[model samples]
Target chain A: MAEAKPIAGTRPLAPKPMSPHLSIYRFQINMILSIMHRVTGITNYFGSLILAIWIASAATSEQAFNTVSSYLATPLGLVILIGFTWSVMHHMLGGIRHFVWDVGWGFSKPAVKFLSWATLFGSLTLTAIIWGYALSHWGIR
Target chain B: MPTTTYRTELKKVRGLGSAIGGPGTDHFWAQRLTAVSNLFVVAFLVYTGLTLAGAPLGEVKAFFGHPFNAIASILVVISTAIHMRLGMQVPVEEYMPHGLKVPFLFLNTFFVIVIAVVGVLSILKLFLGN
Candidate 1:
C-alpha cells in the first residue's frame, strides 16, 4: 500500500477518550428491543395526534368529519392506518415488558430472552389478527 | 464499617447511592402509572374505533355522546397525551444536542399539551351534545 498523504490545511486527528455505547458494546436482543421501543414510541406520538385530529374534526362539523373519514378511506390513508396500528401494538407490548420488569420477575437471563422474543412476536401476531379482521370485513375500506 | 463515625447507620444509608428521591424519580413513576392506564384506555379506544369506523357523521357524534364512550375517550386523550410527553422527554434528554435540549423539551411538552387540550375539548363537545 502507498503511504497516505495529509489533506491541505487539515491537522492530524487526536486520540481521545470516548464514552462506551453503540460503538463498544456487543449487540443484544434487548438492545434492539430498546431501540424499537423508542421508535414505536415516536410513531405512537404521531398516531395519537392523528387520532386527536380525527376526533376534533368530528366535533367541528359533519363536513369536517366526512373529510377526515374519506381521507382515511384512501389508499395512502389506509397504509398510514395500518402502520399506526402496528406501531401501537408494538409499543403496547413494550410497555408490558416494562411492567413485567417492575413486578420483580423476568430478570434471569433466559427469562429476559423469552420476554424480548415474546414482545417481538406478540406484537406482530396481534397486528396481523387486527388487520385480518379489518381486511376481511372492510376489504380495503 | 466505621462505628466511630459520627453518622448513625440510618443516616449513613439514608438517600445514599440510590435514585429514590433524585431527579426523574417522580417522572419515572408517572410514566409507569400512565403506561398502565394507557393499556386500558387504548383497548377501549380501539374497540370504540372499530365500531365507529365508516360510521355516518351523526352516528359518530351520537356514539361519542354516550356518556361511557365520551368519558373513556377523554380519559384516553389526557392519559395518553401525558404519557407521550413523558416518554418523549426521555429521548430528548438522552439524544438531543446540549444546546438544543431545553428547547426540544419545551417543544415536546407544549405539543402534547396543545393536542391534549384540543382532544379533551372535542370530547366534551360531543358529550355535552353541543
Candidate 2:
C-alpha cells in the first residue's frame, strides 16, 4: 500500500521549491569578541568560587587553609590561578567595552572595529602585566 | 552608514518575526545579568566579611548559624552558579557543535547545581553544628 501524503502535491511528485539560498555571509568581528567575553566571564566566576572557598577554609582553621594554600603551591594549580587571573582581566576589559557601548558610543563601523581590536589587545596586555607581578612575588629564585 | 541593511538582513535570517524570540538569551543580556548579580554577591560578601572580621571560630559559626546568613549564603552560592551557567552557555553556544554542545550544556547545569548544593550545605553545617 502507498503512504498517505499531505494535500499539497504537484504533478507526479515534483520537489517543492525552496525560496532561495543566501551565502557568502561570513561572521563579523563583534561576534567573536562577544563570545570571548562570555568565555572569560565563566572562567572568572569559577575563579571567584575558588577564592571564596579559600576564604572560607581560611576562616575555619590554619590546617584547612594550609591544604588549599599548599595546593596553590603546586605548578599546575598556579597555572590554573594564572589562567583565572587572565580570565578576570580579559572579562574586565571586555566589560568596559560594553560599558562604553551602553553610553551609546563605539557601535559604528570603524569604531566597532577599533573597539573589538582593542579588547583583545588590552586583555592580553593587562593579563601579562598582572601575571608578571604575580610570578615575581610567587616564583622561585 | 549602510549598516541599517544588516538589521533587515538579520530579520531575513529567521523565517518570521515570530513571538518566540531568543528570550534575552544573547551574550549581552546574560553578561548584564551576571554583572549585576556579581555586584550584589560582592556587596553581600563584603557585609558578611565585616561582620566576621576578628571573629573567633565559634563566633564565625554562630553568625552564619542564623537563618538569615544561611539564606544569604545559599543565595550567594546559587547566584554564582547561575551566573556561571549563563556565561558558559554563551561560550558553548558560540563555539560548539550540536552533538558536543548538548552534553556541555548539561554538564554546566549539573556543575552549577552540585556546587550550589554542596557549597551552601557545607557553609550551613559549619554554622549549624550539623
Candidate 3:
C-alpha cells in the first residue's frame, strides 16, 4: 500500500502529553506516604484474617479459646499485635488524609507535606498511647 | 471542509477508557463507601480488642454474646472484607502478570467471601449460644 500523504495545507498535529513516570520525580515524603498507605492496607488484610480466626477459635470451645489466647499472650504474638496496631493506626490516618483530599481540601504543597508528616507521627503517638494503656491496664508487659 | 469525529462528549472528557471496559465507576464508589464505614467499624474493633485483651474464655464469650457487640463484630468483618478485597484488586491489577491477573482477581473475591462468611457465622454462633 502506498503511504498516505498529509493534506498539503493542513497543519501537523501536536504530540499528545504522556503521563509522568515515577522514576522521573525526586524523592518526597508524600511519595513514601502514598506507598505506605497501600502497604499498610495490604497488611491489614492478613490482620483481619487473624481477627476472624481468633473469633472462630473462641466460638469453638473453651479449650480452643484458651489455646488461641495463650498463644496471643506469648512474646511473638505480642509483637505481631503491636505491628498490627501500628499498621491499623497508620492506615486509618492515611484514609483520613484521602478523605480530606476527596472533599477538595489539603492539596497545596505545604498542606500535603503537613498531612503526610502528621500521618506518620500521629499514628506512632496513637499506637504508643494504646499500648501504654494496655500495658498499665491489662498487665500485658 | 469540516473535520468530523464520532466519539461522544462524555467519552472525550473521560479520556482513556476504563481498564477492561468494566464497571470502574461502581468499583470506585463501592471502595469509598466501604472505606467510610470501615473508619468507624475499625474504632469499635480496637475498642473490643482492648477490652477483651487477656480476658478469660467465659468473659470473652459473654462480651461477644452481647447483642450490640455481636452485631458490631459482624459489621466489622463484612465491611473490612469488602474494603480489603477492593483494595487488593488495585495491586493485583497493576502488578500481576497478564496470565496470572485474572486468576488472582477471582481468588481475591473468593477469599474475601470465605472470610466474611466464616466470621459472620462464628459471631452468630457465639451470639446464639449465649
Query: Which candidate ranks first by lDDT, i.e. highest?
Result: 3
lDDT of 3 by residue, B11-102 (tens): 56687666445578778888999989998999999889888887887878788789999999999998999899999999999999888999
**B2, model 1: CA deviation in Å?**
20
lDDT of 2 at A43: 72
The residue-by-residue lDDT of candidate 2 on A33-110, one tens digit each, is 887887777677577667567556745675776687677658898788768766766776677788888889987899
Q: Give per-residue CA lDDT, model 2, range B52-130, as digits (tens).
A: 5334456667777788877777677776677777777767776887689999889888877776766776776766665
Tens digit per residue, CA lDDT, model 1, B4-74? 33333343457453356765687888899999999999999778767776777788788988999989988
Note the Cα lDDT for every prediction shown: 0.84, 0.67, 0.87
Which of the predicted structures, 1 or 3, would earn the higher TM-score when compared with the native? 3
By lDDT: ranked, best first: 3, 1, 2
TM-scores of the models, in the given order?
A: 0.83, 0.55, 0.85
- In angstroms, what RMSD does candidate 2 have relative to the true structure? 8.8
Model 1 chain A: which ten-residue window has the lowest total lDDT?
A9-18
Q: Which docking band does candidate 1 fall into? A: acceptable
TM-score of chain A, every prediction, order shown: 0.79, 0.75, 0.83
Off by over 4 Å in 2: A1-35, A45-64, A74-79, A108-141, B1-31, B40-76, B127-130
